[model samples]
Target chain A: MRTLKFLLQKEFKQIFRSKSIIFSIVFAPIIQLILMPLAANYEVKNIYVAFVDHDHSSYSQKLINRVYSSIYFKAAPYSASYDDAMHLIEQNKADIIVEIPQGFEDNLVRESHDKLYLAVNAINGTKAGVGSGYLGSIIRDFNQDIQLQWKQPGHFAEAQTIDVVTNNWYNPYMSYFLFMVPGLMVSLLTGIGAFSASLNIVREKEIGTIEQINVTPIRKYHFLLGKLIPYWCLGMIVFTIGMLVSRLIYGIVPVGSIPLLYGFLAVYLLTLLGAGLLISTYSDTQQQAVSVAFFFVLIFNFISGIFTPIDSMPEWAKVLAYISPISHFAQVMRMVVLKGSGWSDVLPHLGAVFALGVVLNTWAVLNYRKTT
Target chain B: MAAITLDNIVKTYGEKDQKVLAVDQASFAVEEGEMFGLIGPDGAGKTTIFRILTTLLLPDSGTASVAGYDTAADYTQIRNCVGYMPGRFSLYQDLTVEENLKFFATIFNTTIEENYHLIKDIYVQIEPFKDRRAGKLSGGMKQKLALCCALIHKPTVLFLDEPTTGVDVVSRVEFWDMLKRLKAQGITILVSTPYMDEAVLCDRIALIQSGKILSVDTPANTVKKYPTKLYAAKASDMHQLLKDIRSYPGVASCFTFGESLHFTFRQDDAQNIAGLKATLDSGNYLDLVINEIQPNIEDYFIQISEPVHA
Candidate 1:
């Protein structure tokens, strides 16, 4: 409609006239993408290992050497007593303490087994958990090495062992960037798109311009369309920038159909912008709209399975996770980009986002009133 | 048919436990091509009546119509045929003057060229600064630009709510002159103002107070209907003069207007005036002067709305 053209023109002019909005729109996603993955890494490293060796046996020294040689840990200054090692941990200078009992070599040779103790600083739960697991695996491997050297070849054949191999299917190298870039893109795009769109109409309300428009002959749908179209275009631009950054900076390129990824992004943006407009209708000021949008966006990010696997959440939380469009979009992004999934693979996610878009847009239109 | 009509319209705000009446049993009509004014001070329901007729609000009871369209049922039709300028400057401030005008014209399904003659007089005054953003404009310039945007559509009826509330005196006079020119084109104009002096400029005026229409007539007629004689009295100590006259038995209402107190009598006769003068002269009132004066729209507005007269 002719009216829509004017509305769109006016909306774009206002959007661009405010220089601060333009600056943030073009760069916020870039900055977030560049910094988030490096900061949100789950692979824990740089653990400080402190040792308390009472026996001072050759085997104990060998085990200590093996633990420090691994890339996951660094060696701390040696402690003469368990209490001294514990003091190191308490001072935050060491992450994990390894203590060997007295007569550890004699015990292992004659009794065929020995006891070792490990104390980990549990303040940062993830670091403590992962660091202790690495140390335990290293000690187990060292025990096998010593047993093979001491035992006879005939006895070694008598003991049978089960070998387990794992093949990382999607990410062969298990690069965290590859896993995080696509998911972070979903959250970043949703944030920029929803926040700007939510503030649009409410800004007009605060400035008193909405009352002038309400008195005109402009249809409600035309007005909303005018708003949604410009923001949708901006959302696409931000999405493209994110994609280029992921591919260039993180070395991540989608394996599936590029058009299919964009197709889902288009629908996902519609759903988010619809919710944004709904917030605008309920708020009387820009500050109120921003706060309400922030509350919803924060919850969506947490439940979207970007940082944690949805499968690991409790049953109630899992149910709530699936209800959010972000979870579906993040899943589709990972599936299509990482797994090379085709149309049938992502069809369900696309359908869910579309259904949500319809409900949100309908509610927004109904809530908007020309008169009270 | 009246160009605009409100029949016993009543509107209230807030919840059931605490209701504040904004408009109550108020009714008036404006004729075609006539300039009408709803004159009142702040919180006097002038803006509420404008909102009701503009289809921006619905009266809790009774019916109102604009350009022969019912406000409740035919709201969409009414919206299309009416141009409204709210009390606040509601145009897009971030937009340039030309862009704001063009936008309003486009949304109304008409081009600025189509109604160029209607807003030409007012728009020309603001044309030189069309490239400037509206927010940066002076108060008078902003008012002129708002008028142009509201008139771009050239609706059958125009509702302007307190258009000159914050404008300077010179610009206020200029705005009234522009409105007079629009009347020659046979456009029905309904404007409201808190400035009592602006009432006499309208062809017919309705004086409202406390959600009620105190009087609806021509400016001259409303003043002529003053029930009793009014006099202006001033002294060296104007404050004492007001207190002394208010306490007098013959005084119905007395309020300070400018340098003097406008005193109206409960019983107006030659004897009452003479007695009041003698009493004031006997007191410590210095250089006291009293003279009978003709009542204006403000005087009538105060007299009718006064609780003693009610």
Candidate 2:
């Protein structure tokens, strides 16, 4: 116990003395919270639009005005030719192009309907889909107005249609910040837990201080535990700061008990710190440890449902997410903050993280040797 | 009583086909409270043996004990009773001098104040900069700080593995003086160094090479064991003189030492020196001078390490 205390004190002194830890703990969370939401929004607004209106009658002009007035589209007037519209789209100056034939007004008045072509760029598949939906809604509304002006108002009332209402349960507005802040918190904690903790041990190895400790009477387990606990505490402190920033900056607060959120975070931090210990045990140099930790954190963040919904991923990918502690923790974070979940709601996730933490920490302790 | 004992210790690294016998089947013992030295060049397995005794590494096959505790089973007890300063300066660089000292003391379930006298003479010199980080300190200061940390617990035995390998001459001298003081306190000390001059400081020394103990005895006795007459000869052209002496009929071993060539003959024939001089004279060697000198530990090591003839 005394040896453990000494080791812990030494570790704390080393971490606290460096200004880099202060920067990572305080400033990194702020930067991630402020910048990530702005950069990751999926809703497309102010899309530049162009058109080839061969029918330059009042009817085509009115239709063009309607598209220009909507918030989602901006009309960029160009030559009334398909080649010009194609050139605009190719240059990335326009997102969508509409082409109306020469006899559109006469055909629409005489035959009651006319075909129009809408060309959309499908590179960003989701944004293109949403844009196409917006254009279809606008054309449908215009056709309804034309019918109401020409025919009886009750003519459309007889037409049957399915009315589906979607009630978004937890984030009604679907704010991207609400979805992102908690996951960013998980990522931030991972950075501190894995990078800092592993660097601590590897630094000792590089500078030859590990040899000094090896010759001491301190037990291997005690030494490792002492090294891990301080970093675990730092991880918790960073998590709290992340939570506070989430509440203050994004108005996103945990709907569950704060203590419950911290409880899971503590377990998650242990799993990460254990991972750092395992890396340090295997690596002989600081650079190697950093690279290995970076690889794990990168893979974890990508597959852990941090930026994308896990349900949208394929079944095999989802199965892989089950093994990632970050995936489970990120799920718990969203559940507690957005869903008001209780302990029972997170017990399964907590169990997996706990099991992983125990297994990894035990392996780290076993592999850690006093001698080379 | 033996402060340290090893019965046929053997340590090998790597697999059988590419194995390196770091410490071969070697055995020796250091008496209680004696200053014992393991003198050898690099890769001679001096550090390997020190590591095995300190309980940092396990020997593949051996029954060794330090301060009367088995290295394998009683490793914890052995660790508690020994102070080890490894070959490199392994103290925490970011921590302050005082913090490093306090940390090491706390590890042994003791306090710095509890054993202040043990390290006072050494620690007092660096006490002024106790708040400064160890990384910024001079090499000598770092050496003193490491020594203090190792001795903070006042272990029964101290293992210093090449502690003065890279320090300045003044610091090295001071370190040896500090070691002598610790020895007076009845602490059994085991130190390893490649410097043959430091061999004289040990009460007894073991000359090791290629993981094998060549000779173990007092420095005086080891040097006195040189069984042939040694002569230091130099000419105006010393390099040419060395070659000329090697081809002489009765010369047994001829190696250059500093500004002179040290040679021994197969027979201690009085006429051999005159005959060698005549041979050198005929070879156009000028200003030839020869003097009989006593052999040092290095000469003794060279003589033993040489391949023996049947």
Candidate 3:
């Protein structure tokens, strides 16, 4: 135990001596938290609307005015033909095209029905998908307005109609950044901590200092503890700073218990740091360790429900996602912080994370060798 | 009792056909508190034997022990009793000298003050620079700090592999002097070096080459094992002189050492200096000079390492 203390002292001195690591630990999350949510947003806005309105009627003009006045779209040059509007889309001048057929205001007036065509450029898939949905909702709202205008005096008694409204329960405003900042913050903390911890051990190998340590009387567990505990503490500190940034800068204070958030973060770092140690034990050079760690961290991020909703994933991939510690931690972070979930809500996730810690940490300890 | 022992130890690396015999069926022992040296050139497997005894590597076959503990079974006990300074100066570079020393001391469950007497002579030189980072220290100081850290635990046996290989000659002398003092304090020292001159400093030395032991004895006895009378001969045209000397007959070995060629005679060759010189004279060797000289450990090392002699 005393030997481990000395080893930790040595490790911490080295970690603190490096200015680059210090900046990364203190500021990388701060930077990422402020930038990532703004960049990763999927909400489509300010879509360029190009239209070929052949109806030349008051109704067509009113529909065009409604499209321009909505919050989600902007009016671009009117194209005389569908091909010209497509050309505008190809030139990146427009995002969606509205086509009203030559009806002379006859179909909706006489038959109470009309057809409209929409062409959306889908080069950027996510942008295209969300933009089309906005256009669809805008047309639906316009149709309801026209129906209310027509239902004025003695026409029809209370027609059967169903009204639907989307409340977006967790994020009432549908703010993407508020929904994403907590998860991104979690990823950033784990990323920097795991990377620095593994690189530290492999750096010692490259410098040949490990040979001196290997010849000593120190036990393997003692050495591993000495190497991992410092980074674990560093991860928690970084996580705390990230939380402060989310709350202060983005106005994203968690509704759940902050202590519960930290409680799971402490256990999550065990799994992360343990995996990092395993990488260090297997790698002979710092470069190899970094590349391997980068690969695993990327994979963990992709499957962790940080960016995509895990419910939408395929069945097999969902199973694989649940197996990742990041998935469990990210879920708990969202649950506790965003949802104000209690102990009962996160108990299962916490148990799984602890189990991953035990398994990965035990594997790391067993793989470590004082002698080959 | 021997502080360390290796009985017919063998170590190999790689596959069967391309296998390298790093230490091949070699055996030797170092007496308690004796300053033992494994002397050879680069790639001579000096480091391999040190690694085996340090318990950092296991021999492919045969048995070895340190402090009466088996390297295989009692490795933990051996680790507790031994201190190893590997060939490279493998101390933490970013750490201050004092911190490096203190860390190693603590790991061994002791303090530097406990064994200050053993390393006081060496550590005091670098005391003023204790706050300096080890990587920024000079080669000599780096060696001293490494030595101080290795000895902080006061182990029963100390294994130093090429501790002075890259050190300056003056500092190399000081390091060996420190080793002598450590021996006096009853700490058995096993040091290996590629530098042949360092061999004579050991109380007993093993001359090894290409994964095999050539000779094991006191430095004087190893020198005595040189088979024939040797001569130091040089002339104005040394290049031409070598060709003429080799052809003039009774040369068992002729190796260049500084300005002269060390000439040794074959077992059956007559050791008549006048006759040897008369032949060289007839061969038009200019300003030829030949005289008998005592053989040193380097001469014995070369003699034994030569395939013809082995």
Pick the lDDT winner.
Answer: 1
Considering the two chains of model 2, state its CAPRI-style docking category: medium
Per-candidate DockQ values are 0.88, 0.74, 0.82
How large an RMSD does model 2 have? 2.3
Clash count per candidate: 0, 0, 0
Residues A1-372, candidate 1, lDDT per residue (tens digit)? 898999999999998998978877788889999999999999999999999999989988888888888999998878999888889888899999988999999998887789999989999999999999999889878887777777877797744375567899999999999899999999998888788887989988888888888888888889888889999999999889999999999989999999999999999999999999999999999999999999989988998999999999989888878888999999999998899899998999889899999999999999988888
lDDT of 3 at B256: 85
Clashing pairs in 2: none
Ranking by DockQ: 1, 3, 2
Ranking 1 against 3 by TM-score, winner: 1
DockQ of 3: 0.82
User: Which whole-number lDDT from 0 to 100 does residue A262 have in model 2?
Assistant: 89
Q: Each candidate: fraction of true contacts kept? A: 0.94, 0.89, 0.92
lDDT of 3 by residue, B1-310 (tens): 8999999999998898999989988999999989999988888898888888988888999999899999999998888889888888899888899999998898889998998987899999999999999999999899899888888988899999999987998999998888998999999999999888888899999888888988899998889887888889989889887876777666777888889999777753455566678777877765888888999998888777777454
TM-scores for every predicted model: 0.98, 0.95, 0.95
Q: Alpha carbon lDDT of residue A107, candidate 1?
A: 91
Worst 10 residues of 2 chain B by lDDT: B301-310
Better of 2 and 3 by lDDT: 2
| Candidate 2 chain A minimal-lDDT segment of 10 residues | A156-165
